[model samples]
Target: MAGGNGLLEVRIAVPAKDASRIARLLVEERLAACAQVVPGMTSTFRWDGEVTTAEEQLILAKTHRSRFEEILDRVGEAHPYETPEIIAVPIVEASAAYAAWLVDEVAAGERP
Candidate 1:
């Protein structure tokens, strides 16, 4: 999702054990300016035509919209699930200072 600020709030759900590693990877690689790993989340969903519930970790990542595809690719490589839950929503509005900081941090690690 794109917006005037060109910022996105990406959400990625992973196994609780892998939460911190994934968050660190994203932030270290600059795929995300910041990543917060929220643990103790219980997710219930359908998989393979059956209902299931599992403990999960939610990683909330803040990044520029342009870095979304890279984030997906990187997460896919690191994630254990066959189809990981990776989604993003546009950050339609943010404080100017925060927006600028986010953009700057992500941009600092831009690929050639």
Candidate 2:
């Protein structure tokens, strides 16, 4: 289900050092209304038949679904991982204030 604004909450994982950079870039570019970086997370998965564990920081971005592609492109440009974790989950419901703010933030960048 998608809301009127077609908003999405994007999640991406990166090294602790890069978390701030990624979050800042998305906000600075106005691709997201807000970005929250949570640290001290461990992820375990199998790669090439071998299980691996990683220490990662989680980046949560709020933006419209329309900007999902651009968000991925910007994040990839700075992500060190060959395959960075980029996922967007639709926002089925949101308060009117938040929805409006999100739409305005991602529609276009601010002019100086």
Candidate 3:
């Protein structure tokens, strides 16, 4: 279900090898309500003077949209990439119960 303005979209990039570990850490730390690891992503980009291609894992994190920057910062701190990609996209739909849980988990650190 749509979570109004409080809904967040958080994305992080990690090395294929460290994707799983970072995903677990983010969930355990409550930085993200949930994280989905997408595998076999091929990224080609210009680095230095030559084009480079690498296999990467894309992590989609669910959280309050307002907290997008915070989530990005956390991911950056934990990420192994010299320049990690952290992006957020608004969530359009989700299960009500799951959405509620996501809010609750994120509010864990806030004053009630």
Off by over 4 Å in 3: none
Give model 2's clash tally.
0
**Candidate 2 residue-wise lDDT, 3-92, digit = tens:** 655888999999998999999999999989999999999999888899999999999999987788888888999999988999998888
Superposed Cα deviation of residue 40, candidate 3 (Å): 1.2
Q: Please give the range of 10 consecutive residues that has the lowest summed lDDT in model 1.
A: 1-10
TM-score of each: 0.95, 0.91, 0.84
Which residue pairs come into collision in candidate 1?
A: none
Q: After superposing candidate 2, which stretches have Cα over 4 Å from the reference?
A: 1-4, 110-112
Between candidates 1 and 3, the one scoring higher on lDDT is 1
Mind giving the per-residue lDDT tens digits that candidate 1 earns over 23-89?
9999999999999999899999999999999999999999998999999999999999999999999
Model 1: lDDT of residue 18? 96
Better of 1 and 2 by lDDT: 1
TM-score of 2: 0.91
Q: How far is candidate 2 from the true structure (C-alpha RMSD, Å)?
A: 2.6
Q: Tens-digit lDDT track for model 3 on 21-111?
A: 8888777877787889999898888878899898898988788865666667777788887788887777777788888898888777443
